[model samples]
Target: MLAPTHYPLEYHDLRLVLALVRGGSLAKAADLLGQDVSTVFRAIQRLEKALGTRLFDKPRSGYSPTPLAEALAAQAQQAEQALARARQHTLGGEQVQGCVRLTCSEAVLQALVAPALGAVLEALPGVELRLHGGPGFANLSRHEADIAVRLCQQPPQHLVGRPLATVPFVLCAHPRLLQGDGGGAPPWIALEEGPGEDPTGDWRRQHFPAARIAHSAHGLHGVAQLARAGLGRALLPRWLIEAPLQVLDEPTVACASTLWLLMRPDCRHIPAVAKVFEGLARHFTTAANH
Candidate 1:
């Protein structure tokens, strides 16, 4: 009883073997490999010697692959396909056929950006859009996202984009939320904190100094949700106010927040990024800059 020996196989050798099997003759295999017939013959002999077995039967008509050779040829085909798949993945980002991650606040994504997604997809056929909605910002310098949509008066100096929308804040409450609360600013549901003089604390104080505070929430959506649940009146952005939650009064804070489309300098030239960015700007630029 004896054990068959194992041989270390090279990728180049497997290629030649597959070529020989598929081409059915040494001359054709050499042509496939861009080598002379003698070189192909010598390489096949070396492979056979390494395996301690004859791979082909050299009949007068042509070469016939043995059982071992057939198995090895299948392995070669599998290797070819595997390499092809890997190549596709490697080349994925070299073109515009991959995904683009977009980060923004949950409120904005819901109110304005989310609805316009259909148009974004229609324009960029193969580009995938990954939307992440949260409070804290995604770092563009680290490539956390391809783009960011947010409400800011002064966007970070490192990022770049024009103002998308000049969203205004209005007092809104659910129809049954505070019907008979007896006016005097409808009791306030305010944001916990935000940028200078207004957005949360100052705006509430300056506008309705004598009004009572009903509830306070961390994020813009949370503040709106509090109002939606029949809690109290909330000062909210125009985009975030939906049905049932009717405006208690006209917008008092014009340009309370400006929607800015920010992106890293590196991604500015990418076709998908540039195209989507312009599309978003156009979609947001309407007659509603109040």
Candidate 2:
């Protein structure tokens, strides 16, 4: 046989192999790479052809890597680490420039981050911030986001985080709704405890078992709006209290949770990501003190 065809692995090829090794199957690998299963399959085929060797076995359970594939994947991981270190060194503090993705719950975004975004952008003129606001937490391990702001009793162990503030829960209602109800417990605008746990819901149920839930929302922003609309009384985070919505003194629950700013350890080394992280940390730190 002629000498085996020699081909060098590309950056994308390394990423693909590592993703497949970590994800175990094409579908999971596609999800990690943000590509379709078919695309990932074709890429694997191309990589195998280039190397002139079978890299994976099509087992019933999943794609199992061969001995050579595992060795190649290990090298790919080392390469990735080296590249990350190089980027960290190349992008110095003054040279901070890149896009940083930030993810957080909608309530936090509207009340905190969004309002202060102008100042953040002003400080880091060369950096771009992409904010994602939703109820669910973004998977940082999958590179879904570079930074995250989360309100929780305890943050994930894998992420590096700092507690920013203590979010206190308060019962609020529109002046008009309270006036119409005439001093008794007005119908409740309940907060729906979605996938993430919020202790405030438990506090509401434990304290106001007989209260009727006239309307419900999945987030603090939604519940605040419902309360503002004179729909019903809502137990909400104190930060959400605004014009027209009055905080009720009765049934004061000592419910609270900490707000945390988090990021993957590897991402913290990037200049742009670190700059934004510092800016936001300062914002929340100042807000908490006041």
TM-score of candidate 2 relative to the true fold = 0.74
Residue-by-residue lDDT tens digits, candidate 2, 16-132: 988887677898789768899999999999988888888889889988888887877777767766675576578765655667888888998888778767787788887877677
Across residues 154-238, which tens digit of lDDT does each residue of candidate 1 receive?
Answer: 7878888788766678888888755575654466787666542135466668766887887887678888888888788888876
Cα lDDT, model 2, residue 142: 57
> How far is 7's C-alpha from truth in model 1 (Å)?
30
Q: How many clashes show up per model?
A: 0, 0
lDDT of 1 at 9: 85
- CA displacement after TM-score superposition, residue 147 of candidate 1 (Å): 0.7
